[model samples]
Structure formats: C-alpha cells, structure tokens
Target: MGIFDALNTSVGGLQAQSFALQNISGNIANASTVGYKGIGTSFEDLVPAAAATNRQNSAGVTAHSQATITTKGTVSRSSVSTNMAIVGDGFFNVQKPVGITDNIPVFNGVTNYTRRGDFQLNANGNLVNGAGYYLLGVTVDPKTGNPTGNVPKVLQFQNNFIPAQATTSINYAANLPTKPATVASTTATAGGLKAYGGLDPSDFSAGFNPLVIGTPAPPFTDATTSGSTVNNKQATQISGATLLSGAASTDSIITNFAAGDTITVNGTPITFVASGAVGNQLNVTDSVSTMLAKIDSITGATTASSVTNGIITLHTGTASNLTISSSNATAFAALGFASPTTQARGGGGTVGAGVVIGNDIKVFTNESISGGAVTAYDATGTPVNLQLRWAKVDSSSLGSPHVDTWNLFYQANSSATGTQTAWINAGTNFRFSASGALTSPSGSSISLPGVTVDGQSLGTQTFNFGSGGLTQYASTGGTATINNIFQNGYAAGQLQSIAVNNSGLVVGTFSNGQNLNLAAVSLSHFNGTNYLKALDGGAYAATDESGVAIAGATGTINGSALEGSNTDIADEFTKLIVTQQAYSANTKVITTANSMVQDLLNVLR
Candidate 1:
C-alpha cells in the first residue's frame, strides 16, 4: 500500500479509537445513574480504486457512524414509595403544563414518554412530579372507581360530620282524690245526737248520759187510783183520761204512749209499755217535779214544732216557768240555741243560728282558667286585656300554636361563628310533615363538603346510587381494581417478581405485600429495531420511517431475560492498541518515504 494511504488509514483508526474512548468514559461516569444504559462503537473500511472498470478491490480502514446506544441495564429496587422503574419496554405516562400555545402535551400529543416514577402532591391535592406536572390516567371516582376519561379528581380530606352528644327529656301522668257531702235533718233529739243510730251499737258500748227533764224528789212513789167503783167490793176504776190528767201527766212519760217512744224523766229513760192496764202509769211523789217534767216535755214538743227557718223558739204554758239548772250551756250552743238580745221571753227569747256547710269548693285567683280574659299592663299604664278564645285540653294548647322560625346560633369552627345559614323547621319533627314527606331512602349515604388536608383545600365530591346500583367494587366484576397508590406516592418496594400476560401488561410483585402494574410495556416487532433512530435517555421517538409501534408482550421480542450491555470493552482496548500501533506505523511510513526521496535526490546529485 502507498504511504499516503497508510497515513490516511491510521488517522481514521485514531478517530474511531477516540470515539470508543468517549463511550467508555460515558459508561463509567453514569455507572450508578438509575435506568442509565451504556453505549458502544462500530467501524467500517474505505474501498480503494478498482484495477479495471468492473474489477473488485480490497478496502482500506475507515470508521462508520457511532449513533446507537445499548439500552439494556439492571434496575435495582428503590426505597421510595413513588420511585418505580420500568422492567420491559413501555414508558410511564406523565402530564406537564406547556406554554400557552401548547395543547397540554399528551402521550399521543407528540411529546416524549419516560419511565422515572418519582412523584409528589401539589396544592390541589393532585399527584405530580418535581416539575409540578400532574400524573395522567383515567380519572377515578375514589368512591366509585369508575373510569372518568380525561377528567381528573383528587382526594384531600376525611369525614367530619359526627353527631354531637346531648341530653334527653322525660314526661309523666298520675291521679288525685274527691270531696264529701252535707247533713240535712232537723227533728233529731238531744239523746238522738248521742245515739248515732246509723253506727253499729258496739261502737257505743261506752256508756252515755241520758237526756234530763227535771229534778226528781226523794221516794218517788207511783201515783195510785183515788176513786173506788162498786159492784161487790168497793172497786175503784181510775180511767186513763183521769190518770193522764193527774200526777202521771207530769211523769215525763212519752206522750201518746206508743211503742218505740223513747223518753227520759228525771235523767232516767223509761219506755212506755203498751198502755199498761189502760193507764197504769207510775206515780211521781212531788207534783212540782212532775209538773216540771211535763212542762219540759211540752217545751221539747214546742221546740220541735218551732223549728222553722232552721231556728228553734222556746215557750212555756205552765205557772211555774221551766228552768235549766245544768251548766252545760255550751252543749246547747252547739245545738244552735242561744239567748237573743231582743224580746224578753225568759230573760230574752233565744234564737239559733244555722251552720254554713257544703262541699266547700274553693276558686283560686291565679288558677289556669278556660276561656279567661288576660289583663296586661304596658309600661305607659295602658291596660290591654286579651280574651283567650280557645281551651286547653290535657295541657295542650288547642288554638293555632304560634311559632317563629329563628336561626340557631352556633360555631362551625374555632374561627367561624354565625347562625345556621339554612331554613329549619321550628317545631316537632324538624324536617317532616304529618303527611307524606320526602325522605332519604334506606341504605342511602350522603356526603358533605371536603375539608382541608395538609394545608391544602380539596373541593367536594360525592358518589351515590349510580346506574350500576349500590354494589361493592371489590365483589363486582367492574373496573374498580385494587390500587394502593397512597395520597403521597408509591413507597419503596423491591421487585419481588415479574409477570407478563397476553395483553402486554407488565405486572410487578413488590416486597411490601403488593402487586403493581409497572407499565403496560408494549413491544413493537419491526422488520428491524436495529434500523430505528436512537434518542438519548433510553427512549425512541416514533418516526414515519418506522411503522407505528405494534402493541405486544415481552415474549414477542424473542427473549425472556433482557440482553446485557453489547459494549465490547476488550475489543475497545484492542482497537485502542491497534490504533496506536497503526499511527506509529503510518509515521514510520511517512519518514521512510521522505528518506527514500532524500536518497533519490542524493543519487541524482
């Protein structure tokens, strides 16, 4: 080969070696960079001129492009909850705010995708990355877990409406007693008052005093018959009429001499046996005493007769006036007989006063009265009397019970104080009428507004009976899958195992007792992936030159475990040595050519 050709070849070799050295430096520098892939270099030969027009000739050394990088790398487990790494082929989808002219770049919006999984939560309670970009997915209702395509909702607080503790009231009902009646009769005798006939006789076994009429004389002898009627022996027949007119008449005997007539003479009571022997009356010795007893009996009869207008008047028909020698005048006073201050009969005519008696119903002045007039006085002394038109039965007001709907003052929080800003029923069942009222149906759940969490405000959202009805997502065959994505981020987890199904979903097992979908790692089988353009950071942006990425599983790429780095370190070192040797050989060739030319000039001289 020509010395010029050798020099050119050595220079090309030095350039290729330089390129390989650059790749090795990069690999060493980023050896610990997460998800970092290493690079490799390749070379080709340059063809020389052909001997003939169609003759083939051997090529000299030249370097080709160093465009591609080895994307294979080992993914070590991280200790962060949100740190995730893609195992197979796909990228994690993230959303970032672009300039106003940008249409919020999406995965399908001509923006690049990534596999880095570090994330955080923003002020709006949305999970985001360090760039303040939201994570993208089908928005899920936390309660329902249904796919709300493109619309995103976030969770930021907990439940706060718990019923407060309070006290309860009680009510009661019971009974009371009644009143008694009054007495009427006036013909009661003095002894009759002591007898108490309606009461059992055993009640009066205690001895009682008999009513007295007049003073008795010693040796109270019975009166005898004076005239004798003849037939064979001078028989004297004293007639009843004559006996009645004599001392027997003043004997204090019960008049009419009828059965059941109780009478007292000289403080002793003797019942008259039926008209004994047509006038067999016991004779009293003292005619004055006998006359006094008779007059006293007549006085009792007259008193009984004079009991008109509830009063009794006493009068005497005998020459000797009747006198009461007993000092028990208070007993007579109890009988309503007292000396009158007016007319003089004995000393003065006595009159009796009647007793005021009945049920004695009392009317209270402050009692609650039905249909009463209420007199009210104003501050200006204006007397206003209102008449209550309705009655209260069983303590319940029967008229239209006046009610005013007023706000209940309360404090919602330590800083907030105001009346409840809603209309509330003023009485009874607060929210229902006696008739049919709208009710929250059974098994229904209601949600209130969301509260602040971690110093960020989250708005209200709710989930109720939807078209799928009240069903538990875990039990139902719905899209509500188990997702343990916490509000913060995915915590540190080791890749316990990896799984791939026919649907191209790459599910990863974690050491933290969870199974997560690392990514829907899609695979595209091209005529060749070797021909695809290489973008840095282990990504490949699609171009029209390469057909659309065919979604597939890892097995479609004809490998289970990934390929390690294609970097040939030994070959690179050998190439470096070869390049050094060739450069030295090329310099020697240039020197030899210069020396031969010098020798030719010497020979020519």
Candidate 2:
C-alpha cells in the first residue's frame, strides 16, 4: 500500500511538472510580444488525513497559473505619434468587434481593457491596435476643447471643413522708445519734419520751427514781448511766490490782476475775486500759479499751463482748443499773453476722417515709424495685412501744454493717387506721462473701428496691450521693440494629423495652422489586476473576483512610446531547466517504486 501511494504521488508530481513546463514554454515563446504579462506556474501540495496524529501521507501536487499583470514592462520610443504607453498601473479602455456589418466592425457592446498601445489610425479614422481592439475616448468640443461626456466611446476623427473665424482681438506688446527714429527724425540722415504729406513742423509748433537754421521768433512770445525780456526765458519760473494781485509788491506781471478782473479761456471765465469761495474763482491775493490753474481747467488741456524760467506756456492738448481773452486787457497782458490768444489743438480734426489722400502719402512715409505688422483674417478667410505706424503728433519739448503724444496709422491703399485716401489714422491720441506710461483711454485696449486695408474690410477689432504690455523706455536703437503680437482668429482648416499629448489628450493639427484637442484618452484601472481573466492580444476581461474598472487612473501616459512584454527569455529558460529536472526526479521515484513492487513479487514467487 505504501509503494502504491508512492507511485500515485509520483504520477501527480509528473502532471504538475508538465503543467509548469507548458507555462515556461509559453512565456519563452511570447517574450517578444508587446505588453504581455507572463504567466508563472504555482504548485500546491495535497496531503491525506490519517487516523492518528502525525501520520499523514502525501497525496499529490497540482499547478495553477499565476498572473504577473501588475508588473511593469520596459517602454521604448515609437515613431508613430498615436502610439502610447502607460508608465504605471492602468489600462486603455478598448472594444473588440464580434462581427462585421457592411465592412464596419460590429462590437458586442462589451468594454475591455488592454496594455497594448501600438495603436494606429485606420482607413475609417478609428484608432486600432495590432490586435484589432478599437481604442475608446471621450469626445472634445472643438470650441471649448473640453471633454463632452463622462463616459468614453470609440473615437473617430474625420477631415471636415472648419469655418473661417474673423479676428476680434490682437494681443500686442511692445516697448516704444522715448524717441522713435523716423526718416524725418532730426537724428536720421534723411531728417526733415514729416507728417501728412510733409506737413511743416511749424504747424505742430504753432507756426514756429525750432529745427530751422535761422534764429526764429519764439511762438510763445507776443509781438511786443521778446524772449530776451525779463523773466521770459524757457526756464524762468512764474509760479510759487510770484503774485498776480496788484495788492502784492512781488507782482509777476507789469499790470497786476485786480478784483473783478476776469480771464476768459476757451469760453469759460475765471474771475479774480477779492477773497472768495472756491467755485472757479481765483482770489486777488492768490499767486500766478492759481491763475494758471484756472486757465488750464477751462481749456481742458492735458498739458497744463506752466511758467519755466519766467516764460509762460499754454497747451491745448489734443482734446480741445486753447483760447484766452481777458475783460481787462492790461491784466491779461501782464500775464504775458496777448488779448484773445488762441492755439488749435494738435492732432484734432474730424473724428472719422482718418484717411490721408494720395497727396499726403509722401508726408506719411517720412514722418511715421513702423509700429509693427501682422496678418489677420476676415469672415471669409481672406487674409489682410495690417500694417501699423506710429507718428509723433505732439511733443513736450515744444513747451508746456504739449505732452509727448502719438497717433497710430495704417495703410488703406497702396495705389491711391490725387485725392484718393491712402492711409487711415486710428483716431486715438496715445498720450504718455513723464514716465512713459499710457494715460489715455484709461484701459489696456483700444478699438480700431471700420478698419479697411487695401479694400478688404476687417470690421472692428480690439488691440489689447495686456497690463504693462506696452512700455516707453530708452532704446539703444530708435525703433519700436516688439515683444509679442498675434491675433486670435484663423482661416478655415482641415485636420492633418493627430497625436496624443502627455496629458492623455489627442491633439489634432489642422492644415490652416491651428492645433486643437480632439479627444481625451480614457484610462481604466482595476482593484485586483491579477484577478482579471486574460484574453487574447494582451487584453483582459473583468471577472467576479476582479472589481469593475474605475475611471481616472493614476498612471501617466507617455506619447509616441510603447510598453514591451514583461516576459524575460532568460528567466523562462532557467525555469524550463528546473521543470525538466523536477519531472526526471519524479520519474525516478516511479521507477524506484516499481522496483520495490517487482522485488516483492519475486520474493512471493
């Protein structure tokens, strides 16, 4: 009975070793397979129960397959953009077709998971791995580029026509030099006062050109008052302690202002009250600075009236005109102003009359500096080159009331002759403070309304200078330093190529030079990965032991790469030698057991 038990146990051992050999052979064969999780043989021993304690007999041994599903495999670079690899624990949600209908694969609606990521786009635009498993993903909205649904389905991308989008805003950032170099800049070799078809510098300086050779009469000086006169130089101070009231001995003017004496500026009267309340009235005992404030307030001048080196300067800015007339002629003359003096505002004209006729193109070319250029699209996908230029309209160097100001221009027509409009002004007075920061429009954006470039209308668009996007700093070269400039709209485009990004989103590049996210790759993870029932092609199906797949796996997807099979040929070969040795040892046990039985039979004979 003992020898018989030995034979039966040895037989069971042979069967278990055979099972292990099969597993080792399979692992060695599939060592080159992609994303393959190798199977290992697990042996369990069986023992027979005895009537007394410590008297048990070995019955048999059985082998069961062990899954290395949770083990990681080596990842290698792939040339195919659609190919992907998981660096950790997760599987790609996929579907297998049970049949074909009209050339299209019909799925059984059962979702499967796989680690094989050798996916390539098929003729139907669906992603399929080498094993014919279709990849699934969440659809992305073209406009928002966000996932549309929580559940994932088979993803398909087609080359459909995209509608044209008109540009609404241009993000622009640049550093404007304190002094931009233009053809007409005094520093440039071709320097001459240029603007609006050679509009004379005298026009900007109120009929006086400082750049001229000869010593010209200062425009701020009246006919009777010369610059050489007392307290009339460019640097003379007329404010502070200097009084304009006749009651004060230190009077600023030859004829001091008396009570009831009024100075009317731009149709608003500033009355010199003896001692007064603060409603637009200057006290007779107040300083000349008080009188200057009243004048500046009435004219709405951005550059206020100031006296430098006793010389008084009045500016109209670009918003309004400057006009000063006094009820008392002597008092007005004492303030160094001729009765009824007037100065037109710089860069102020008809609001929408932005165009300069062909006659003024030469003037514009010489005066304006290139602001920058960009290509924009219309509603019909037509391209329009938006060329920008900056023209210095007014300068603080001209005197008080004239701040550094600029106007933007664009090319309207290249071939306009005679009276045909060739250029258009943006109709904004870009005023800069002493520190070169924008002070007008009170915001980061300005509108270029009704912009038509070379007969192509590009509707209204906003030019945004993000907070601190535009600056005016000292430049090594007297040119505009553009940091960034681009538009948001693009022409119609067709899908050209698609690739997975590190974020696991499928991005598609279009023929029109736009890249958009098309879909999001779905990653499903299982609680008990080894409990999953292995299927063909490195895929796995959920069993009762393995919990349902959970969405949003923690593993990262590497694009343009793939995972190799986990099976190692060297390790499987070592296992193979051990299994063969174990089988031989079991066969020896049966042979020895047979010898014992044969010896007993011989003795009985």
Q: Give all candidate RMSDs, comma-separated.
A: 30.8, 13.5
lDDT of 2 at 385: 91
- Which predicted model would earn the best lDDT? 2
- Each candidate's TM vs. the true structure? 0.32, 0.70
> For candidate 2, lDDT tens digit of each residue in 57-106?
66889999999999988999999999999999899999999988898889
RMSD of 1: 30.8
Residue-by-residue lDDT tens digits, candidate 1, 1-605: 45456556655666665666666666556555444445556667677777786875544565544533224455544443444444565543444544433433333343333333443434443445443434443322222234444432221211211111111110111110000010211222323211211111111111210001121111111111111121121122222322221232332222122333323323334333334322212232212223224434643423221222223333442222333221232322322333211111221111211100111111100111112222222223232332211100111011234111111111112221122111111111111112212122232322324322222222231212222222211212211122111111122345454443333333445554445544333233333334445444434454566554444324322112222333445655665566567656656665776676677679977
The ten-residue window of minimal lDDT in model 1 covers: 173-182
lDDT against true structure, model 1: 0.31
The candidate scoring highest on TM-score is: 2
For model 1, the stretches where C-alpha displacement exceeds 4 angstroms are: 52-58, 65-71, 93-108, 114-141, 144-146, 150-538, 551-605
> For candidate 2, what is the lDDT?
0.78
